[model samples]
Target: MRKIGGLLLCCFLLNGLNGQHQVKTRKELQREVIRCINESAQQYKVMMQRLDAARFPVTWYAKEDKLVTSGSEPWVGGFYPGALLYLFEYTKDSALYKEALQKLNVLAKEQYNKTTHDLGFMMYCSFGNANRLAPKPEYKTILINSARSLASRFNEKVGCIRSWDSDPGRFMVIIDNMMNLELLFEATRMTGDSSFYRIAVAHANTTMRHHFRPDYSSYHLVIYNPANGSVLKKQTVQGAADSSAWARGQAWGLYGYTMAYRETRDPKYLEQARHIARFLLQHLRLPADKIPYWDFDAPGIPDAPRDVSAGAVICSALLELATYTPLKESKGYMKAAEKMLQSLCSPAYRATIGGNGGFLLKHGVGNYPRKADIDVPLIYADYYYTEALQRYRKLGMKR
Candidate 1:
């Protein structure tokens, strides 16, 4: 009788939480998302009117009130184009598609860039989306080569891809590196190259073993001994402290593991994703709006800057997770994701039609510690926000 009572209590609690939050219907959300995308397309058109092909946007500088752009090799170069592709997919606007292709043309040279571990961000996000939409032969070749470049960074000794080389002596693997595995997985699917799949699995397994706390909150970076495969330090570069949960880092882990599960059908990966989601959702510090503070443990509680990029990422991942889980397990995830989408569509986070420097979402905390791109509009935030809308649209269509 006690066990049966506990189950009933659990169901009651879940129902209460779901009932307390009222989200927009699919039709309402679709209209709002489409309006936002149309506004974003127009904003980009104005911004791109003066942009040189050699530069790509990274974030908006509110103090300067201008778009911050970088060269072709920056990790964030692909996101602008990726967001454009999402807009194109949704609006079927030829201008958006043309601009995205132009940016991808400029971004194509990064396929051979082996100096960095971000080829996935630089190449795959751009070309991979292009291939999915257009199915061009050249895009596949670009992605396959980009995967090869990313694979070149893998060290068997550390059982992970090297994320940074700044320290020279230390082999660094970051939680953010988890986001890159999608490129490798896609490569295996495109070319039947099991090597890419193996490398991705090795990295995911190694990360799962070391990068997470018992509670499943992830550290930002893990430094390993390059020669002996020994962990030297587990630290955070962008989080509040070495021990705190960085909002974006956790989001990356959730999204990455969710993607990993989809690609490999690994139960461990799914469990990990669910665990991380629980940590994020159940944390007391999470704001009522479904967006998180820059760090879960960051000082100032309600005063800390919200990371819309993190929220956008989690929103997209949860929508995908909803499709994969059982109905009972999926209800909360879907509701939470819908709430996030509603929050993002609100005036507080979503930029006005002509504002926010051509970005879709506003007020993302890029790296609070580094004092970089704080409380500004970010390209990746827009990319993932649009991606989430696309996913939600597909789900609604299925219904």
Candidate 2:
């Protein structure tokens, strides 16, 4: 009778928990979530005051015409200002929204800022999502214009999106393009012309061909025959190019394809996403604590340090995969995600002290050549870290 009563009590608790999301509209739930987001966003604003905006163009580094360093990132700017727009969206704070729009519009006019790798991160992170959530026709116009600007970067010869913002023929493509394609796809949907979607699909298909090896681990960069569109070399373009596997690059593919499948509903994209997920789980070395190295193939971990940012990205991706994946496979992905979230929430990966910036993750390497922000803080790390938490908490409870 005691054991039976315990099981009944558990069932009662579970049912009530599952009811929260079902009963709330997206707007209503987001209202509550925004309360939490604002606390972090306010802290983030204060920290960002330190950055020198002119020098630290965020995301990827650019070419410097000097010898001591082949390239120079030289400073620290990142993609989080756009993320602030989310707080604005949820709160309807006109000031916050306007400030973010101003920043992106200014960035749009920046002639030097032209990397295509993070079109979504740079543009869609604010303006694109703004257009979707708010539906302002004028912002819609800006979003369309941004799409055209992004489409202009597509290399017809390579059939891929160009990245790294360097020389024209030194073409390089990376896994992060999957997120950028959504910008392009949405542009097509918004404009009712197929051209933007066509470019996005072409880039996605091209990546499926050139980036993945037979075993399914990916190359970070592929240089193409710019003149003829032949892939000249498939190199481990980042993280020790000598056959080392980058953990975040792997996560990008896992999440990217899952996202691709969500958009295109193509089985091949889902399979590729699964292939990478299976490889990571099967080989992931769960130390005493469960976070991962920046690179799985990187020698000397625990002592060398691990990247919580990668784990956070993968955790959210796996959870999304769990929702859409077959039931049997879903269990494993959710389990891995649980482990990652547990690791991130722990004292090891999380930022404990105050005023160090609002970023939740530690040990995220931007380019590594640029700086070693060892276990420091990163904005995207915090964004995805919080996302994984919210997703995990609301797993079966959500719409």
Report the number of the highest-TM-score candidate.
1
Residue 8, candidate 2: Cα error in Å is: 48
**Candidate 1, which segments miss by more than 4 Å at Cα?**
1-22
TM-score of each: 0.93, 0.77
lDDT digits (tens) for residues 122-232 of candidate 1: 887889899999898999999999999999999999999999989879999999898999999999999998999999999999999999999999999999999989999
What lDDT would candidate 2 get against the real structure? 0.63
Candidate 2 residue spans exceeding 4 A from truth: 1-42, 48-78, 87-105, 108-115, 286-289, 369-372, 393-396
TM-score of 1: 0.93
Task: Write model 2 residue lDDT over 116-137, tens digit each, in one string.
Answer: 4565655665566556666787
Error of 1 at 16 (Å): 23
Question: What would you estimate as the lDDT of candidate 1?
Answer: 0.87
